[model samples]
Target: MGIDGGIGRLPLAVADAVRTGGGEIRTGAPVRELRRTADGWTVVTDGEVLRADAVVVAAPAPAAARLLAADSPAASAELATVDYASMALITMAFRRDDVASLADGSGFLVPPVDGRTIKAATFSSRKWGWLRDAAPDLFVLRTSIGRFEDEEHLKRDDADLVGMSLADLGAATGLDARPVATRVSRWDGGLPQYPVGHLERVARIRAEVAKLPGLRVCGAVYDGVGIPACIGSARTAADELLTATLAAGAVGGERE
Candidate 1:
Protein backbone atom coordinates (compact mmCIF):
# COMPACT_ATOMS: atom_id res chain seq x y z
CA MET A 1 0.00 0.00 0.00
CA GLY A 2 2.95 2.27 0.71
CA ILE A 3 5.28 3.54 -1.99
CA ASP A 4 8.99 3.18 -1.27
CA GLY A 5 9.86 6.86 -1.54
CA GLY A 6 6.69 8.82 -2.13
CA ILE A 7 3.78 9.37 -4.48
CA GLY A 8 6.12 11.21 -6.88
CA ARG A 9 7.96 7.94 -7.51
CA LEU A 10 4.87 6.30 -9.01
CA PRO A 11 5.36 7.66 -12.54
CA LEU A 12 8.94 6.41 -12.71
CA ALA A 13 7.87 2.96 -11.48
CA VAL A 14 5.04 2.85 -14.04
CA ALA A 15 7.40 3.92 -16.82
CA ASP A 16 9.90 1.22 -15.84
CA ALA A 17 7.17 -1.38 -15.88
CA VAL A 18 5.99 -0.20 -19.30
CA ARG A 19 9.56 -0.45 -20.64
CA THR A 20 9.89 -3.93 -19.25
CA GLY A 21 6.72 -4.84 -21.10
CA GLY A 22 8.28 -3.55 -24.37
CA GLY A 23 6.36 -0.25 -24.42
CA GLU A 24 8.00 3.14 -24.94
CA ILE A 25 7.40 6.14 -22.73
CA ARG A 26 8.03 9.53 -24.27
CA THR A 27 8.31 12.45 -21.89
CA GLY A 28 7.77 16.10 -22.88
CA ALA A 29 6.37 15.09 -26.21
CA PRO A 30 3.34 17.26 -26.87
CA VAL A 31 0.82 15.46 -28.97
CA ARG A 32 -0.58 17.60 -31.76
CA GLU A 33 -3.41 15.49 -33.10
CA LEU A 34 -4.89 12.03 -33.27
CA ARG A 35 -5.85 10.81 -36.73
CA ARG A 36 -7.76 7.67 -37.56
CA THR A 37 -5.82 5.70 -40.13
CA ALA A 38 -7.11 2.85 -42.27
CA ASP A 39 -6.01 0.13 -39.86
CA GLY A 40 -5.21 1.91 -36.60
CA TRP A 41 -4.40 5.34 -35.17
CA THR A 42 -1.72 7.91 -35.86
CA VAL A 43 -0.63 10.00 -32.95
CA VAL A 44 0.97 13.16 -34.24
CA THR A 45 3.24 14.99 -31.88
CA ASP A 46 5.51 17.96 -32.22
CA GLY A 47 8.47 15.79 -33.06
CA GLU A 48 7.12 12.59 -34.58
CA VAL A 49 4.14 10.56 -35.65
CA LEU A 50 3.51 7.24 -33.93
CA ARG A 51 1.11 4.59 -35.15
CA ALA A 52 -0.78 2.22 -32.90
CA ASP A 53 -3.61 -0.25 -33.09
CA ALA A 54 -5.35 1.33 -30.11
CA VAL A 55 -5.40 4.89 -28.69
CA VAL A 56 -6.44 5.97 -25.21
CA VAL A 57 -7.11 9.66 -24.87
CA ALA A 58 -6.55 10.18 -21.15
CA ALA A 59 -6.01 13.93 -21.08
CA PRO A 60 -8.26 16.56 -19.55
CA ALA A 61 -11.71 16.99 -21.04
CA PRO A 62 -10.95 20.10 -23.07
CA ALA A 63 -7.72 18.73 -24.48
CA ALA A 64 -9.33 15.40 -25.30
CA ALA A 65 -12.14 17.24 -27.06
CA ARG A 66 -9.65 18.98 -29.30
CA LEU A 67 -8.08 15.67 -30.23
CA LEU A 68 -11.37 13.94 -30.98
CA ALA A 69 -13.31 16.86 -32.44
CA ALA A 70 -12.47 16.03 -36.05
CA ASP A 71 -13.64 12.44 -35.80
CA SER A 72 -16.10 12.25 -32.93
CA PRO A 73 -18.05 15.48 -32.90
CA ALA A 74 -20.69 14.53 -30.36
CA ALA A 75 -18.20 13.21 -27.83
CA SER A 76 -15.95 16.21 -28.36
CA ALA A 77 -18.83 18.59 -27.73
CA GLU A 78 -19.72 16.82 -24.50
CA LEU A 79 -16.11 16.92 -23.34
CA ALA A 80 -15.93 20.61 -24.17
CA THR A 81 -18.83 21.27 -21.83
CA VAL A 82 -17.00 19.75 -18.85
CA ASP A 83 -16.00 22.47 -16.43
CA TYR A 84 -12.77 22.80 -14.42
CA ALA A 85 -11.46 24.64 -11.37
CA SER A 86 -8.09 26.13 -10.52
CA MET A 87 -6.14 25.90 -7.26
CA ALA A 88 -2.81 26.87 -5.71
CA LEU A 89 -0.67 25.35 -3.01
CA ILE A 90 1.68 27.44 -0.90
CA THR A 91 4.27 25.38 1.00
CA MET A 92 6.31 27.04 3.70
CA ALA A 93 9.08 25.92 5.97
CA PHE A 94 9.42 27.50 9.41
CA ARG A 95 11.85 27.10 12.29
CA ARG A 96 10.13 24.86 14.82
CA ASP A 97 11.12 27.04 17.80
CA ASP A 98 9.61 30.19 16.30
CA VAL A 99 6.10 28.75 15.86
CA ALA A 100 3.43 28.32 18.50
CA SER A 101 2.17 24.93 19.56
CA LEU A 102 0.24 23.22 16.75
CA ALA A 103 -2.86 21.11 17.16
CA ASP A 104 -2.43 17.36 17.68
CA GLY A 105 -3.85 16.48 14.30
CA SER A 106 -2.07 16.81 10.93
CA GLY A 107 -4.10 19.78 9.63
CA PHE A 108 -7.52 21.36 9.20
CA LEU A 109 -9.90 22.59 6.50
CA VAL A 110 -11.39 26.06 6.44
CA PRO A 111 -15.02 26.30 5.46
CA PRO A 112 -16.01 28.69 2.67
CA VAL A 113 -18.28 30.53 5.08
CA ASP A 114 -15.19 31.54 7.10
CA GLY A 115 -14.30 33.98 4.27
CA ARG A 116 -10.62 32.96 4.45
CA THR A 117 -8.25 33.00 1.49
CA ILE A 118 -6.86 29.58 2.35
CA LYS A 119 -9.25 26.67 1.89
CA ALA A 120 -7.13 24.13 3.78
CA ALA A 121 -3.73 23.62 5.33
CA THR A 122 -1.62 20.52 5.92
CA PHE A 123 1.29 20.16 8.37
CA SER A 124 3.50 18.21 6.00
CA SER A 125 6.29 17.45 8.43
CA ARG A 126 3.87 16.39 11.14
CA LYS A 127 1.68 14.35 8.80
CA TRP A 128 4.49 12.45 7.06
CA GLY A 129 7.03 10.65 9.20
CA TRP A 130 9.55 10.67 6.38
CA LEU A 131 9.44 14.45 6.03
CA ARG A 132 9.69 14.96 9.81
CA ASP A 133 12.69 12.64 10.12
CA ALA A 134 14.43 14.33 7.19
CA ALA A 135 14.17 17.82 8.71
CA PRO A 136 13.46 17.61 12.38
CA ASP A 137 14.20 21.29 13.10
CA LEU A 138 11.95 22.64 10.34
CA PHE A 139 8.17 22.67 10.24
CA VAL A 140 7.00 22.12 6.67
CA LEU A 141 3.41 22.99 5.93
CA ARG A 142 1.26 23.81 2.89
CA THR A 143 -1.99 25.74 2.40
CA SER A 144 -4.40 25.24 -0.48
CA ILE A 145 -6.30 28.12 -2.04
CA GLY A 146 -9.08 28.65 -4.61
CA ARG A 147 -11.96 26.37 -5.55
CA PHE A 148 -14.70 25.94 -8.11
CA GLU A 149 -16.39 29.27 -8.96
CA ASP A 150 -13.90 30.98 -6.62
CA GLU A 151 -10.55 31.69 -8.22
CA GLU A 152 -10.09 35.42 -7.72
CA HIS A 153 -7.57 34.76 -4.95
CA LEU A 154 -5.34 32.91 -7.41
CA LYS A 155 -4.74 36.17 -9.31
CA ARG A 156 -2.70 37.59 -6.44
CA ASP A 157 1.10 37.54 -6.41
CA ASP A 158 2.95 34.60 -4.87
CA ALA A 159 4.19 36.68 -1.94
CA ASP A 160 0.67 37.96 -1.29
CA LEU A 161 -0.70 34.43 -1.42
CA VAL A 162 1.92 33.26 1.04
CA GLY A 163 1.11 36.19 3.31
CA MET A 164 -2.62 35.40 3.19
CA SER A 165 -1.94 31.74 3.97
CA LEU A 166 0.26 32.72 6.89
CA ALA A 167 -2.42 35.09 8.21
CA ASP A 168 -5.02 32.32 8.03
CA LEU A 169 -2.62 29.94 9.73
CA GLY A 170 -2.15 32.48 12.52
CA ALA A 171 -5.90 32.89 13.00
CA ALA A 172 -6.63 29.13 12.81
CA THR A 173 -3.73 27.69 14.83
CA GLY A 174 -2.29 30.74 16.66
CA LEU A 175 0.97 30.16 14.79
CA ASP A 176 2.68 33.53 14.17
CA ALA A 177 6.01 32.27 12.83
CA ARG A 178 7.82 33.64 9.78
CA PRO A 179 8.75 30.98 7.26
CA VAL A 180 12.38 30.64 6.14
CA ALA A 181 11.44 29.26 2.72
CA THR A 182 8.29 29.19 0.64
CA ARG A 183 7.17 27.58 -2.61
CA VAL A 184 3.97 28.29 -4.52
CA SER A 185 2.57 25.74 -6.95
CA ARG A 186 -0.29 26.84 -9.18
CA TRP A 187 -2.60 24.57 -11.15
CA ASP A 188 -4.85 26.29 -13.69
CA GLY A 189 -8.09 24.50 -14.47
CA GLY A 190 -6.84 21.55 -12.47
CA LEU A 191 -9.94 19.93 -10.96
CA PRO A 192 -13.04 19.05 -12.93
CA GLN A 193 -16.46 20.07 -11.67
CA TYR A 194 -19.09 17.39 -12.01
CA PRO A 195 -22.50 18.99 -12.39
CA VAL A 196 -25.79 17.11 -12.16
CA GLY A 197 -25.86 15.40 -15.56
CA HIS A 198 -22.13 14.48 -15.49
CA LEU A 199 -22.56 10.71 -15.47
CA GLU A 200 -25.04 10.77 -18.33
CA ARG A 201 -22.75 13.01 -20.36
CA VAL A 202 -19.89 10.63 -19.75
CA ALA A 203 -22.00 7.69 -20.83
CA ARG A 204 -22.95 9.48 -24.02
CA ILE A 205 -19.30 10.29 -24.72
CA ARG A 206 -18.26 6.70 -24.18
CA ALA A 207 -21.01 5.37 -26.37
CA GLU A 208 -20.18 7.77 -29.18
CA VAL A 209 -16.45 7.08 -29.01
CA ALA A 210 -17.02 3.34 -28.87
CA LYS A 211 -18.60 3.48 -32.30
CA LEU A 212 -15.12 4.05 -33.67
CA PRO A 213 -12.65 1.18 -33.59
CA GLY A 214 -9.41 1.37 -31.56
CA LEU A 215 -10.44 4.59 -29.79
CA ARG A 216 -11.11 5.07 -26.08
CA VAL A 217 -11.25 7.97 -23.63
CA CYS A 218 -11.00 8.05 -19.84
CA GLY A 219 -9.91 10.55 -17.16
CA ALA A 220 -11.03 12.64 -14.20
CA VAL A 221 -13.47 14.48 -16.46
CA TYR A 222 -15.48 11.32 -16.99
CA ASP A 223 -15.24 9.66 -13.60
CA GLY A 224 -13.95 10.47 -10.11
CA VAL A 225 -11.09 12.90 -9.82
CA GLY A 226 -8.89 11.03 -7.37
CA ILE A 227 -5.86 8.99 -8.45
CA PRO A 228 -7.59 5.69 -7.63
CA ALA A 229 -10.61 6.63 -9.74
CA CYS A 230 -8.47 7.70 -12.67
CA ILE A 231 -6.54 4.40 -12.50
CA GLY A 232 -9.73 2.38 -12.42
CA SER A 233 -11.16 4.19 -15.42
CA ALA A 234 -7.94 3.68 -17.37
CA ARG A 235 -7.94 -0.03 -16.56
CA THR A 236 -11.56 -0.38 -17.68
CA ALA A 237 -10.90 1.43 -20.95
CA ALA A 238 -7.86 -0.73 -21.65
CA ASP A 239 -9.79 -3.89 -20.92
CA GLU A 240 -12.65 -2.85 -23.18
CA LEU A 241 -10.29 -1.94 -26.02
CA LEU A 242 -8.44 -5.22 -25.78
CA THR A 243 -11.62 -7.23 -25.59
CA ALA A 244 -13.10 -5.57 -28.67
CA THR A 245 -9.86 -6.01 -30.60
CA LEU A 246 -9.73 -9.72 -29.78
CA ALA A 247 -13.36 -10.27 -30.67
CA ALA A 248 -12.91 -8.59 -34.04
CA GLY A 249 -9.88 -10.73 -34.77
CA ALA A 250 -11.84 -13.86 -33.95
CA VAL A 251 -14.65 -12.85 -36.31
CA GLY A 252 -12.15 -12.14 -39.09
CA GLY A 253 -10.49 -15.53 -38.54
CA GLU A 254 -13.83 -17.30 -38.80
CA ARG A 255 -14.70 -15.45 -42.01
CA GLU A 256 -11.33 -16.43 -43.55
Candidate 2:
Protein backbone atom coordinates (compact mmCIF):
# COMPACT_ATOMS: atom_id res chain seq x y z
CA MET A 1 0.00 0.00 0.00
CA GLY A 2 2.90 2.37 0.72
CA ILE A 3 6.64 2.70 1.05
CA ASP A 4 8.35 2.19 4.41
CA GLY A 5 10.81 5.08 4.53
CA GLY A 6 8.26 7.33 2.90
CA ILE A 7 6.34 7.81 -0.33
CA GLY A 8 9.37 9.74 -1.63
CA ARG A 9 11.36 6.54 -1.79
CA LEU A 10 9.10 5.18 -4.55
CA PRO A 11 10.38 7.66 -7.13
CA LEU A 12 13.96 7.02 -6.08
CA ALA A 13 13.46 3.30 -6.50
CA VAL A 14 11.88 3.85 -9.92
CA ALA A 15 14.89 5.95 -10.89
CA ASP A 16 17.16 3.13 -9.80
CA ALA A 17 15.23 0.69 -11.95
CA VAL A 18 15.49 2.97 -14.97
CA ARG A 19 19.26 3.26 -14.52
CA THR A 20 19.62 -0.47 -14.02
CA GLY A 21 17.80 -1.11 -17.28
CA GLY A 22 20.22 1.08 -19.29
CA GLY A 23 17.92 4.05 -19.29
CA GLU A 24 19.14 7.62 -18.95
CA ILE A 25 17.19 9.65 -16.46
CA ARG A 26 17.81 13.33 -16.83
CA THR A 27 16.95 15.94 -14.22
CA GLY A 28 17.35 19.66 -13.60
CA ALA A 29 16.44 20.27 -17.25
CA PRO A 30 13.21 22.15 -17.43
CA VAL A 31 11.39 21.06 -20.57
CA ARG A 32 10.80 23.94 -22.94
CA GLU A 33 8.67 22.25 -25.56
CA LEU A 34 7.56 18.92 -27.01
CA ARG A 35 6.67 18.53 -30.68
CA ARG A 36 6.01 15.63 -32.97
CA THR A 37 8.72 15.11 -35.56
CA ALA A 38 8.50 13.16 -38.80
CA ASP A 39 10.80 10.58 -37.29
CA GLY A 40 9.42 10.68 -33.75
CA TRP A 41 9.15 13.23 -30.96
CA THR A 42 11.48 16.15 -30.39
CA VAL A 43 11.85 17.09 -26.75
CA VAL A 44 13.41 20.50 -26.25
CA THR A 45 14.62 21.04 -22.74
CA ASP A 46 16.86 23.61 -21.08
CA GLY A 47 19.81 21.43 -21.95
CA GLU A 48 19.18 20.04 -25.44
CA VAL A 49 16.69 18.77 -27.97
CA LEU A 50 16.51 15.03 -27.53
CA ARG A 51 14.92 12.75 -30.09
CA ALA A 52 12.92 9.79 -28.91
CA ASP A 53 11.09 6.91 -30.54
CA ALA A 54 8.13 7.68 -28.27
CA VAL A 55 7.41 10.23 -25.58
CA VAL A 56 5.24 10.09 -22.50
CA VAL A 57 4.29 13.26 -20.71
CA ALA A 58 3.78 12.43 -17.06
CA ALA A 59 3.03 15.76 -15.50
CA PRO A 60 0.35 17.79 -13.80
CA ALA A 61 -2.55 18.86 -15.99
CA PRO A 62 -1.41 22.45 -16.53
CA ALA A 63 2.10 21.47 -17.52
CA ALA A 64 0.81 18.68 -19.69
CA ALA A 65 -1.56 21.05 -21.43
CA ARG A 66 1.31 23.38 -22.28
CA LEU A 67 3.45 20.55 -23.64
CA LEU A 68 0.69 19.24 -25.89
CA ALA A 69 -0.58 22.57 -27.10
CA ALA A 70 1.54 22.54 -30.27
CA ASP A 71 0.95 18.93 -31.32
CA SER A 72 -2.48 18.18 -29.91
CA PRO A 73 -4.50 21.29 -29.21
CA ALA A 74 -7.61 19.22 -28.61
CA ALA A 75 -5.93 17.30 -25.82
CA SER A 76 -4.47 20.51 -24.44
CA ALA A 77 -7.91 22.08 -24.28
CA GLU A 78 -9.29 19.11 -22.41
CA LEU A 79 -6.39 19.13 -19.98
CA ALA A 80 -6.77 22.86 -19.34
CA THR A 81 -10.26 22.28 -18.03
CA VAL A 82 -9.17 19.70 -15.45
CA ASP A 83 -9.56 21.13 -11.94
CA TYR A 84 -7.24 20.54 -8.98
CA ALA A 85 -7.13 20.80 -5.21
CA SER A 86 -4.32 21.68 -2.83
CA MET A 87 -3.27 20.55 0.67
CA ALA A 88 -0.52 20.82 3.24
CA LEU A 89 0.85 17.92 5.20
CA ILE A 90 2.20 18.56 8.67
CA THR A 91 4.52 15.92 10.03
CA MET A 92 5.35 16.17 13.69
CA ALA A 93 7.60 14.15 15.91
CA PHE A 94 6.81 13.77 19.59
CA ARG A 95 8.37 11.88 22.46
CA ARG A 96 7.10 8.32 22.77
CA ASP A 97 5.73 8.92 26.28
CA ASP A 98 3.59 11.80 25.03
CA VAL A 99 1.28 9.69 22.87
CA ALA A 100 1.94 6.24 24.28
CA SER A 101 -1.75 5.64 24.65
CA LEU A 102 -2.80 7.03 21.29
CA ALA A 103 -5.70 5.54 19.41
CA ASP A 104 -5.24 2.20 17.64
CA GLY A 105 -6.22 3.10 14.06
CA SER A 106 -3.85 4.39 11.43
CA GLY A 107 -5.83 7.59 10.95
CA PHE A 108 -9.24 9.24 10.73
CA LEU A 109 -10.79 11.31 7.97
CA VAL A 110 -12.85 14.32 8.96
CA PRO A 111 -15.83 15.25 6.82
CA PRO A 112 -16.00 18.72 5.31
CA VAL A 113 -19.27 19.32 7.15
CA ASP A 114 -17.40 19.05 10.51
CA GLY A 115 -15.52 22.30 9.66
CA ARG A 116 -12.29 21.08 11.31
CA THR A 117 -9.01 22.77 10.52
CA ILE A 118 -7.37 19.38 9.96
CA LYS A 119 -9.29 17.15 7.62
CA ALA A 120 -7.41 14.01 8.59
CA ALA A 121 -4.73 12.75 10.95
CA THR A 122 -2.54 9.70 10.56
CA PHE A 123 -0.87 8.09 13.58
CA SER A 124 2.30 7.24 11.67
CA SER A 125 4.13 5.66 14.57
CA ARG A 126 1.35 3.22 15.25
CA LYS A 127 0.35 2.62 11.63
CA TRP A 128 3.76 1.77 10.23
CA GLY A 129 5.88 -0.75 12.09
CA TRP A 130 9.00 0.27 10.18
CA LEU A 131 8.60 3.90 11.18
CA ARG A 132 8.07 3.04 14.83
CA ASP A 133 11.09 0.72 14.88
CA ALA A 134 13.30 3.28 13.17
CA ALA A 135 12.45 5.96 15.72
CA PRO A 136 11.68 3.99 18.85
CA ASP A 137 11.97 6.94 21.18
CA LEU A 138 9.70 9.18 19.12
CA PHE A 139 6.07 9.15 18.03
CA VAL A 140 5.54 10.55 14.55
CA LEU A 141 2.23 11.63 13.09
CA ARG A 142 0.95 13.51 10.04
CA THR A 143 -2.06 15.79 9.68
CA SER A 144 -3.56 17.14 6.50
CA ILE A 145 -5.33 20.47 6.04
CA GLY A 146 -7.19 21.63 2.98
CA ARG A 147 -9.52 20.03 0.46
CA PHE A 148 -11.15 20.56 -2.96
CA GLU A 149 -12.39 24.14 -2.67
CA ASP A 150 -12.26 24.84 1.05
CA GLU A 151 -8.58 25.67 1.46
CA GLU A 152 -8.72 28.82 3.53
CA HIS A 153 -6.77 27.08 6.31
CA LEU A 154 -3.84 26.46 3.91
CA LYS A 155 -3.38 30.21 3.36
CA ARG A 156 -1.95 30.51 6.87
CA ASP A 157 1.79 30.34 7.65
CA ASP A 158 3.50 27.10 8.62
CA ALA A 159 3.54 27.93 12.32
CA ASP A 160 -0.13 28.81 12.15
CA LEU A 161 -0.92 25.54 10.38
CA VAL A 162 1.06 23.57 12.93
CA GLY A 163 -0.71 25.36 15.76
CA MET A 164 -4.11 24.62 14.28
CA SER A 165 -3.27 20.94 13.90
CA LEU A 166 -2.00 20.78 17.45
CA ALA A 167 -5.13 22.40 18.78
CA ASP A 168 -7.32 19.93 16.94
CA LEU A 169 -5.17 16.98 18.06
CA GLY A 170 -5.37 18.10 21.68
CA ALA A 171 -9.15 18.29 21.64
CA ALA A 172 -9.61 14.98 19.83
CA THR A 173 -6.92 12.82 21.50
CA GLY A 174 -5.98 14.87 24.55
CA LEU A 175 -2.49 15.35 23.06
CA ASP A 176 -1.06 18.49 24.66
CA ALA A 177 2.68 17.86 24.49
CA ARG A 178 4.86 19.98 22.25
CA PRO A 179 6.44 18.23 19.32
CA VAL A 180 10.22 17.78 19.16
CA ALA A 181 10.30 18.50 15.43
CA THR A 182 7.88 19.43 12.68
CA ARG A 183 7.89 19.71 8.89
CA VAL A 184 5.30 21.08 6.50
CA SER A 185 4.92 19.94 2.89
CA ARG A 186 2.52 21.82 0.67
CA TRP A 187 1.02 20.45 -2.54
CA ASP A 188 -0.46 23.29 -4.57
CA GLY A 189 -2.89 22.21 -7.30
CA GLY A 190 -1.78 18.66 -6.67
CA LEU A 191 -4.91 16.55 -6.41
CA PRO A 192 -6.89 16.44 -9.65
CA GLN A 193 -10.65 16.67 -9.28
CA TYR A 194 -13.04 14.51 -11.29
CA PRO A 195 -16.28 16.27 -12.01
CA VAL A 196 -19.28 15.31 -14.08
CA GLY A 197 -18.38 14.09 -17.57
CA HIS A 198 -14.75 13.55 -16.50
CA LEU A 199 -14.57 10.18 -18.19
CA GLU A 200 -15.93 11.65 -21.44
CA ARG A 201 -13.41 14.45 -21.26
CA VAL A 202 -10.57 12.00 -20.63
CA ALA A 203 -11.74 9.91 -23.57
CA ARG A 204 -11.61 12.93 -25.86
CA ILE A 205 -8.15 13.81 -24.60
CA ARG A 206 -6.92 10.28 -25.21
CA ALA A 207 -8.49 10.21 -28.67
CA GLU A 208 -6.77 13.43 -29.67
CA VAL A 209 -3.47 12.25 -28.24
CA ALA A 210 -3.75 9.03 -30.24
CA LYS A 211 -3.96 11.12 -33.42
CA LEU A 212 -0.35 12.14 -32.89
CA PRO A 213 1.91 9.14 -33.06
CA GLY A 214 4.66 8.71 -30.47
CA LEU A 215 2.97 11.20 -28.14
CA ARG A 216 1.22 10.03 -24.99
CA VAL A 217 0.21 11.58 -21.71
CA CYS A 218 -0.32 10.20 -18.26
CA GLY A 219 -0.76 11.40 -14.65
CA ALA A 220 -3.40 12.02 -12.01
CA VAL A 221 -5.54 13.96 -14.48
CA TYR A 222 -6.08 11.10 -16.88
CA ASP A 223 -6.87 8.39 -14.35
CA GLY A 224 -7.17 7.88 -10.60
CA VAL A 225 -4.98 10.06 -8.34
CA GLY A 226 -3.66 7.49 -5.93
CA ILE A 227 -0.01 6.44 -6.19
CA PRO A 228 -1.00 3.05 -7.52
CA ALA A 229 -3.31 4.65 -10.09
CA CYS A 230 -0.67 7.09 -11.26
CA ILE A 231 1.84 4.31 -11.58
CA GLY A 232 -0.67 2.28 -13.55
CA SER A 233 -1.38 5.20 -15.85
CA ALA A 234 2.32 5.65 -16.56
CA ARG A 235 2.64 1.95 -17.33
CA THR A 236 -0.37 1.99 -19.65
CA ALA A 237 0.92 4.96 -21.58
CA ALA A 238 4.37 3.46 -21.88
CA ASP A 239 2.97 0.18 -23.09
CA GLU A 240 0.71 1.83 -25.64
CA LEU A 241 3.51 3.97 -27.05
CA LEU A 242 5.92 1.07 -27.18
CA THR A 243 3.38 -0.98 -29.06
CA ALA A 244 2.76 1.81 -31.53
CA THR A 245 6.49 2.37 -32.07
CA LEU A 246 7.21 -1.29 -32.61
CA ALA A 247 4.26 -1.73 -34.94
CA ALA A 248 5.48 1.17 -37.08
CA GLY A 249 9.02 -0.26 -37.21
CA ALA A 250 10.38 2.67 -35.22
CA VAL A 251 11.91 0.35 -32.62
CA GLY A 252 13.97 -2.77 -33.16
CA GLY A 253 11.22 -5.11 -32.05
CA GLU A 254 8.80 -6.40 -34.69
CA ARG A 255 5.27 -6.78 -33.50
CA GLU A 256 3.07 -9.57 -34.85
Candidate 1, 15-64: lDDT as tens digits: 89999998777889977898887777788888887777788999999899
RMSD in Å for model 1:
3.7
- Score candidate 2 by lDDT: 0.88
- Candidate 2: misplaced stretches above 4 Å? 252-256
For model 1, the superposed segments whose C-alpha errors exceed 4 Å read 1-4, 250-256
lDDT of each: 0.88, 0.88
lDDT of 2 by residue, 18-39 (tens): 9999887788887889878777
Please give the distance, in angstroms, between residue 209's alpha carbon in candidate 1 and its true position after superposition. Answer: 0.8
**For model 1, what is the C-alpha lDDT against the true structure?**
0.88
